[model samples]
Target: MKNNENSDIHLVINIAQQTLILYQHNKKMAQYAVSTAKNGIGSQQDSGCTPLGKHFIAKKIGASEPINTVFIGRVPTGEIYEAKLGMLHPERDWILSRILWLGGVEEGLNKGSNSEGGCDTYQRYIYIHGTPDSEPMGEPLSHGCIRMRNEDIIKLFDQVEAGTSVVIIAH
Candidate 1:
């Protein structure tokens, strides 16, 4: 992405507050409640935790998909999420609406592995995405990704593009 593409807007996810704040030109534009990893924060593969540090939106998906549209492997599953469907598949980790696929920028912390124990955020498929309405927000409940409400995700997706900067902070 060009350097100017995301110079005006950025995102900050505060794990402690369980909130995602959107900033444009260094001013707060919006804030939304979010759910981080239930397992807490880590950068190792399969750790089921949210990785910290600097990241950028590597991909923007589901541009025109309807809210509650299900996604598997970042591909639309053609299934709209609802109460009945969620009940039918109790074990499914629902990735709904849009996806802001994140790629770490700080090497060894989140971008790439290093001697001190690190992993790739993109490789781990870490994303800021939609979750079912039934799920709780402002809490640590997701497997790893930052989970937002379906409507909130859609709103965010429309406002940002690939290459937008994001920062995840433990405090």
Candidate 2:
């Protein structure tokens, strides 16, 4: 890995392709298939839809937590997540491995409704997080956050730090 002292990574989520691309100073570092919100991608506060446009990693959660460990409120629940467990709690939104909390940088797009008559979406707690192993990726299937495989998220978590730039492009 070429760790340039100034190597800054950019995470771009393409809603149409259901893919997340990691770039190091405009050069593609890696790309991973992702699963977005089932309701589709949008940026309205509390709309239960993934926000679009420029954002930053406001927080990085689950740094060394074991894979499959359940997380609620960004803290490990001390319970190892299993596919069967998910089946029992079918309504659960499984957030495992790591979490990249996103904050909207655009004013009305995500930060909140603009004074000039636009919607605000940042008040909503949005994230890109790990999902159960059995969950299908490359498909829309989340409340509002982006989902990735546990292993893939772990790898990504290791590569990124807080304040990383993330952009979610609408489909």
Candidate 3:
């Protein structure tokens, strides 16, 4: 990751290309392949799908935890991720490494339009987090949150903080 004197990092996620771009201020720093929701994209509360449009890192979790540690609901489970262990829990969502919790910036689309009903975006609990090593990285495979490799997630976790601007653009 490239360091800049800028106060915030700009993040762009492309679902079609399965890539995440990190920019310090306006300068490109790093780009890594990612896996998004298997159900495709949309910005809806309780959709169990990836949201598009503008979002922000509402919360940051797992700061000093070791890589490949298992996390459930953004809290480390104290069990390290292992291939055999993963095979045991074949159905686990498997949030590993770090978590960058995302909350929708667009009120209507994500937070719910007044025409629809009042819904809380933050309660939806969308995030960009790490997945098990056995999982495919450059494909759409998550329930909703974006999934990245352990190393990539850790690197990204260090570069950005809570409230960092994250833009999800569909191709």
Pairs of residues at least 3 apart in sequence or in different chains that clash in candidate 2? 110-122, 112-120, 113-120
Model 3 misplaced stretches (Cα beyond 4 Å): 1-8, 112-121
TM-score of 2: 0.89
Determine the C-alpha RMSD for candidate 3 after optimal superposition of all C-alphas.
3.8
Query: What TM-score fits each model?
Result: 0.95, 0.89, 0.89
Question: Alpha-carbon error at 93 in model 2, in Å?
Answer: 0.9
Clashing pairs in 1: none
Instruction: Note each model's CA RMSD in angstroms.
Output: 1.5, 4.0, 3.8
Top of the candidates by TM-score = 1
**The 10-residue segment with the lowest total lDDT in model 2:** 1-10
State the lDDT of candidate 1 residue by residue for 59-87, as single tens digits.
99999999999999999999999999999
The lDDT values for all models are 0.92, 0.82, 0.82
| Ten residues in sequence with the least summed lDDT for candidate 1 | 1-10
Ordered list by lDDT, greatest first: 1, 3, 2
lDDT of 2 at 54: 80
| Per-residue accuracy of model 2 over 63-163 as CA lDDT, tens digit each | 87888889988889898899778989988888988888887777777776765443444357688899998889998988889999989899999998777
20: Cα error in model 2, Å: 0.2
Number of clashing pairs per prediction, in order: 0, 3, 0
